[model samples]
Target: MMGNTRELPAPQRGDSWNTYECATVLCAVDGCDHGACQSGPFFVVSISLDEDKVATTIMYSSDTGTWSTPASLDLGFIESDISISWMHGVLSGGALHFILMHDDARLGVLKYDLGTSCLSEIEPAFEIQSARFDSHALIAPEDGQLGIARLSGFNLSVYWREVCHDQVATWTKSEVIDLKKHLLASNPMISHTELVGSVERTTIIFATTNIGTYMIDLKSLRSKKLTSELRLFNHPWALFPYFSFYNPDKLRTRSI
Candidate 1:
């Protein structure tokens, strides 16, 4: 709720980032029983408000206009927090790829041939535990990457990397960059994931319970002050602002 913001038209889907895709994240607003939604280039997935059950749709946008009703992707049971990876047409020859990860350990990555409308699972070298794969998700193709930042083992700040190529595999641990103990403490909000952007190069945005809003740069492994504090009203209970990706320049953000 950025107070009485001008009404926005229901978003027509956005253009497909078939080019250099920058990492982007879509998270749930605090306290909405409607679960949350996360979208990648070709897919948008969500879960039941209170159930572990999940559903996903096959979708693509030629321009930043209308989003087709996403086609549901079938699964064994149900789950959430899905991450997708697409081919550059460089290594995989123009195929769309995605990884459906559930907190309960169920994970699968599928490759879809748009021309043929065929889907197949190409298992990875590792089991690819979805839970361990940081809840804070990001898909930044423009910056040449996709990743997430989270507090591993409680306090150490870390992220998972997406390996895109002919060698195709699961996410791998990144070079560990430590956050200052004094400046680093995980927030209690359910949305306690990392929010990063490349105003120049991903200066991450996170609200520290102690310090208010913070900006961290993963490329330089540096952290700095952004704001003294922000008053987020009626934060919708469970909906904390654990951002997966951020680009304040390209879009409008609301802060109450």
Candidate 2:
């Protein structure tokens, strides 16, 4: 039950806190192999969106024990009429990915590049433009590229970003998995399904159905029911994967 007692500094734009979109990530220091350990130097990045479609980012460094100046970028789209969903952001390929949503519809994805300090928009594939925002989940980098998984009815479609030698990038449909064939055999009452979240750098995904929640392995095409009863309070976008690490050698020496 470890926690950070230090509080983050307020955003430079005073009213930015009123927005609902924000993400915090702990990243390993360069050339360090500590793997997210607290003893090693690391960076804590925090980002939030302003009402004017600009994103402000502030970073805290363990080495300096100070927070960096807030960096701002204009998202180049007007969303004053719509609201962004309050959901966890995806970090991949040296950038953070957030969904721009309006009601039940997903307008697009906003990407913030940490190294370059640039903000850009990623359009959804044409085939999935009609799908609701709740049916999609941004996957971590697979084979060095970011991907998105969309659940439409009982079928899940995975798409990957492909870059050509000329530096142009595009999204390509990689594969599709039929959940009906994998899950209906055991839980036949599942009438609706929505993507909840995904594990970083893996094919495992968490999904919710009319019956309950499930942990699915896309690699093996297997589904495991995590809960028997549906949890109505668990909104698809609000759920995130929690990861923890510990040293076994140090743990064994502790007096019980």
Candidate 3:
């Protein structure tokens, strides 16, 4: 796994009000990792509080090393309606989707359109029946569709957006993998696992517990242990593309 740490600068006079405060409150430790995205370039998306108005702002860097001015969305989101998930967002179909934990105990998918600079919310296709400990992830798999995984009990409920081009996407049940039926006998610790990351297009889910990290094949129901050392800390957002592992410049480019 790749590890990264960042330091926030002090609030400046011309900066947005609560710029430092929100960065401190929302991005404590690895929280910023959750709000960030990287493709050909890097971009950081953040919610900023300015004069009591909460607006989303983004700073992006291209192949060039310099960062552009922070751009804020014209509209604002409700502070009480949706709580942002502290997981790295899935970028697909020209939009970035962040998992939203709603006030009514439902998961909301917040999509920020890069083309239109619009923010919209999509309710989860299914109710959240899993326990609080059960993990949820938004993935852009190799098929170029938006995927969601809910690891509840002994099964992982996989949901996919079947029609990706529609204004209102359609989500359908993909598959349910029963982990306990396959691996619990070998490692009881599989009972308590959280999704940390995945290898895009590889059809493998990377999960970790106190014991170590393991990869489960989405099709074969087979799992392979990747690490055996006990994790000192678990940062689910501590993931970057392996192809870009050696390029610090790309990773450093866009951070909100």
Candidate 4:
């Protein structure tokens, strides 16, 4: 499992009005054996937006133990109108994908490539772009490709990014799950549903409803209720799923 020991503080810049956001992604450690703990060589990417709506990016490399020089992010023509979402980013295709919001509405996605240190924009599916922000979530499938899951009323639609022969990327609707028929069968009192979080490299996604929270597997349409007592209310995007594994060998040989 990957391990981190140092606390990475955000780079200081701008005044009190600056909005800062950051995300971390594990890097591939060279020549490392299986079951080894990788503590370094990862990346922490921080993005800051000033009052003028200009965005700047700075990256921290664990190998160098230092932050890179901040560079202005060219958001193209829409730079003045959009802002990056604070929601946890989805790592796919060796890039960190963040949601873009325009005046409280979902615009699309922003892609920050780790290898090239370049930024790009990804247009969301038309159906997804028109839906409410909380109803959809960006996900990374097991194949490490970019994908999205949207919950529209009682149905859940999933889309995967596909590249055509012309090298143009498009979103293909893969499948739809009938949530009302499946979820409402057991609990008929479920009023509203919203997609919250997803497990990276897996088909597992978490959703919240007025009744409870559920963990659903997109492959088999199987679901399990994680909690029923805690209602998320209006904050459907509050849940963030984190996965980690503990090495039993280290635990068994501990000095204490």
Model 2 C-alpha lDDT versus the unseen true structure: 0.70
Candidate with maximal lDDT: 4
TM-score of decoy 1 = 0.43
* Model 1 alpha-carbon drift over 4 Å, by segment: 1-54, 58-69, 78-135, 139-141, 153-167, 181-207, 228-256
lDDT of 4 by residue, 173-207 (tens): 97678998777877999888877778888888888
TM-score of 3: 0.65
Per-residue lDDT tens digits for candidate 2, residues 1-256, read: 3665655555454554445356565655664434446656666766666556666666667677776777776764654344444556677787877766655475577777778767677777766555764477778844556778888788898888777899787889976788899889887877878777787767778888777888888888888988756443455555666767767666555467
Deviation of model 4 at 149, angstroms: 1.0
Give the Cα lDDT of each candidate.
0.37, 0.70, 0.58, 0.73
TM-score of every model? 0.43, 0.82, 0.65, 0.82
Candidate 4 ranges beyond 4 A from true positions:
1-5, 9-18, 25-40, 79-81, 132-134, 234-237, 248-256
The CA lDDT at 52 in model 1 is 24
Give the runs in model 3 whose Cα sits over 4 Å from its true position: 1-55, 63-81, 103-105, 129-133, 164-166, 229-233, 239-241, 244-256
Task: Write the residue-wise lDDT of candidate 1 on 157-188 in tens digits.
Answer: 33444565776545656655545432454334
Q: Candidate 1 vs candidate 2: which has greater TM-score?
A: 2
